[model samples]
Target: WVRGTRNGDMRDSPEESPEEQDRDEGSSPSDAKPDVTWLGTPISELGRMPDCGQQLPRLKNVSGQHTVLIRTDLLQNGKVPVPYPAKFTDTWDDVHVKMPWSGMNLFPVINEVMVLEPDAAEHLFGSLLPDMVQLALRASELCTKPIPLLKGGMNHSITMSQEQVASLLANAFFCSFPRRNSRKTEYLNYPDINFFRLFEGASPKKIEKLKTLMCYFKSVTEQRPTGLVTFTRKSLDRPPNWKSSQSQLTKLHITCEGTIEDDGYGMLQVDFANQFVGGGVIGSGLVQEEIRFLINPELIVSRLFTEALGHKECLIITGTQQYSSYTGYAQSYKWGGSHQDSTPRDGWQRKCTEIVAIDALQFRSFLEQFHPARINRELNKAYCGFARPGERSQNLSAVATGNWGCGVFGGDTRLKALLQMLAAAEAGRDVAYFTFGDSQLMTDVHNMHAFLTARNISVGEVYDLLGQYYSSVCKSCLSRRPDVSLYSFIYQQVSSSLAPDASDN
Candidate 1:
């Protein structure tokens, strides 16, 4: 998938290699007019604004050749012929080909250097497109059908069959839902899955992302899996006194290496999500959760109907399959290749793995995060995500997470770690923290955990200490040791309280 085709594939057939096929057809290796036309109009002008509820235009190729235009930058010595239309000549832009369906006016963005597979294209539009369109229409009708909201520490989980997921995704594929694609502050809270941004002002990076997405669609449509999946939104009421608890703190393992997905199988994986749900899937922002969604494209479908997660809310998704492998981070990311998910299904035919999406506050100023109210909000958010409905400690698995909001969100790693630990302890669950290559954080967290453990400090004690530390910092009492780390401050506070008379001895 990512590398294109293998040597022994159909591309190597006697008719012509895929690249040569592009050249021999309407696409010219040298600057020459393309043999195809749209009702005598130039290919560039074929992009007309679509009407209401109109289907996307049909794609056509000259000489009955089914070809896909791939961007040149992604290939070696790849270039769209100079004499082609201005849209095709631009090196910085994705190749924009007008669809053939009359009155249907959507342009499918493709690279300038590749050709399409007729069989693949036929299967994609012929078999999949109609059903996808119908599904989208049906979903639109149900948008206002009044599903119950998860509120006030309530626990709710909905099971969506594979067919239902495909339907939800179909709406996203067609960009059918309204109130998306707007950057206005009000709409910022919602996830946008429409390809409008990708279609307009397309970039090489965006084009690659689009390719990975298309490959995912191809795989799912070809072989519809019979498994069902579940999405659970959990909310929890804050305990009045987390400090007075006598319960021992849940198990804790902190490391500066590894990731939630790779090392923490069978554990609940944490998705450091944007409030908008899918994060930057439609854009170029690739962070922790975004990267996870790309590898497991099925997870992207959640954005279809998932509203922005609130402060007291968290989403738990089960049974989404990982369909692709990727490398790099953020802008440098690339789809490595196709992946076949082999994770076994449970009695419900759902994958046993579970993922929790919890959005962290995007603090503008570091100090804003330390306020008591802000801290409480984060605590509730994490606790909501960690709490398993009706499950006790014996059945609850440990949590797997990393420097969740530390990257783009500009969060304090130590503070975030402590918050997570407090929540996990409250829910009677353990934590496996990955620092994601941050050695300093790993060491510091390990030392802090050790110090707290040696003194048998409960999570409630840590919570009380955090309040005292925050007050000291706020009152400028700790300005004398301004460089002191959060962990050190907490450690000193806990030690003094635990062995107050040891200093005199």
Candidate 2:
């Protein structure tokens, strides 16, 4: 949702596929300006599921003819077409519940990323209390290679918390090193720091946790069986000793997070061979092979089997990885904008430098109950025509006037009740109706059902209504846009609940 303010606009990046890019390249549809596309790649009813869970619903493979909306001004009025082909209807979820309904509200913190380098490494990693350390503890050690977030500034940083650093370290430490004949240390300039650098002058308590974290990394590196994966440098690449390997080769078999079925493995090499004394190569030192892997932390966390702490079946990991670096006062975009074209080229040069992980099981579980059905229904009803309560218009008007802009009621009792209802809802309860602000209107209705049958309350109707309610009829009618207040609330609540607090934000 793009919210317009007196000053500027704020929009969240929803995942769009190649087809969506094509449609966005053209004229937007008159009726359906792009709003939130349905969640996930469309799955058919007969879609495949992971071996562990029930099959999920899928939509038909969309064709290019589908037209989605695009901001003409953002693209200089179509000078450069975004690769978003919005060819399908803005689909709401299929299932839903009535309003005045309350179920559950759970927000989970899943993943985070940060910059760690000589300048900020101490600041970033020093803040943790050992007891709270989760990922980068001994079990998973962090590994590093030169992955620049800035265009030319090699002094940039990529830092994650101890837990993620540990997991990352565990996954990559002791992997094959780049061969001496073809070293790339010039590209890998970030100062190397690890668990040892941390807790150097630690308290006994902090030291204990640090020890535990280090031990975990050590055990994995020493005992875990290593495996091999190929890293290909196209012939035209720049010349470093490593790049000079003319004959095509599968040089390193680094540890990675993949079996056979999943090929999301990443490529990395820890260069310990080249020694610099007075900026020149010292007598050839024994090449130390540090570990690096091409693995998505989200996939790893998703696959882990655990029952303790906040655990959920499906963890929802959502966030953007952008190029950014710190100046004096604030962060400036490292790359001007999302480097859609340059990402593939530069991504290969950049390596995973740090990890910031979180436990999102509770949040994921809460989100599961709503799904597309709940969101479609609630969002639909919030806008559709209201069913007049039994009370007179004056009474209803009084309630509306009273609650206008009033923060959600339900107080402490309501919060407790909502939490209880969420638990019951998980067991499949009929309490969704009570969750809506306009409970009297959206009686037990599926979101798609409302979309199909509710003559007075289409999804568009709700958007218009919200635009009308939040900003007033005159402004909405004039601009045909909802105010920032409406969508910001939705995004703020959703994002913080889904992932960890982004320091970059």
lDDT of 1 at 490: 88
Encode model 1's per-residue lDDT on 442-478: one tens digit a residue: 6676677767777788777887777776777744633
TM-score, one value per model: 0.69, 0.20
After superposition, the stretches of candidate 2 with alpha carbons farther than 4 Å from their true spots are 1-219, 222-461, 473-505
* Model 2 lDDT tens row, 41-114: 12121111121122222212123211112221233211322212332122212111110001121211112222
Backbone clash total for model 1 is 12
The window of 10 residues in a row where model 1 has the poorest summed lDDT is: 7-16
Q: Which number leads on lDDT?
A: 1
Model 1: lDDT of residue 441: 64
